[model samples]
Target: MPIDNNYTVKRIPPSDVDLYKELRLEGLKDTPEAFGASYRDESTNARSYYYTLLENHDVFGVYRNTDTLVGIAALALSPKEKLKHKGTLWGMYIKPEARGNELAKQLVLQIIKIAKETTEEILLTVVASNVSAITLYKKLGFIEYGTEPRALKIEDRYYDEVLMRLPLT
Candidate 1:
């Protein structure tokens, strides 16, 4: 189904740390393999950590009913002088109840739009087994570059990630 016209997308500010953190933890716990960070690690972080994330990156949130945040994604621009032209798309997640409405696609397109302003390219790594996400990235013009074997290890199990990039230049 197409995204609901009522759903709105906007940059998540630090003031919405509570809402963002809740959604972030839900994603981490629900789909451990899709994200690089584990709930165990992030759940222990101080509120300041989340504050810094909102302060430093372009974190986007999709809201249902214009008030309830249901999805999130971030575009982290490299601060290093050598990598300043690069940006990484990470922490993308949509609540189970909010999936299948093309919210993820809409959220990502907004991220790409923001990234294009400052970065020469956007990079992302999605778990190899996530066919749907990989397909979505391809549809958005991301090209697979390579795979990183054992990209993430959790409780003796390993997951490989497909590295993909979309050059804005």
Candidate 2:
């Protein structure tokens, strides 16, 4: 499906921390395996922690015409000199209802646009079991570089992740 024309994609500023946090927690709860962070760990964080995330990370959000935030993606640039040319793409989530509308693609394209200005490459990891997400990343030109076995253990089960990277330069 094509992206909804009414949906607007923009960089989420720190002043909108409450909205971003709400959408983030929803993502963590809805699909725990898709994200690296667990709901248990994030739910305990204070408002300041979320605000700090906005301060340090470049977060982009997709909002519906009705003023509801439906999707989010974040880009984190490496501060160290050795890794300054690389950045990590994380915290990408789109509401279930918002899926299939290309909002995820739009969000990612926006992140990539912003990332190109500062980094030569962007890296991300998707759960091996999540074929849809992996497919999406590949469609956006992210190539798999490696895989990490048992990357995450939730309770008794383990999940593997496929590491992928897209070079901008």
Name the best candidate (by lDDT): 1
Candidate 1 lDDT (Cα, whole model)?
Answer: 0.93
Candidate 2: tens digits of C-alpha lDDT, residues 113-143: 9999999999999999989889999999999
As for model 1, its CA RMSD to the true structure in angstroms is 2.0
Where does candidate 1 clash, by residue pair? Answer: none
Question: Which lDDT values do the candidates have, in the order given?
Answer: 0.93, 0.91
Question: What is the Cα root-mean-square deviation between model 2 and the actual structure?
Answer: 2.1
Scanning candidate 2 in windows of ten residues, the lowest lDDT window is 1-10
Please list the residue runs of candidate 2 whose C-alpha ends up more than 4 Å from where it truly belongs after superposition.
1-4
Can you give the TM-score per candidate against the true fold?
Answer: 0.95, 0.95
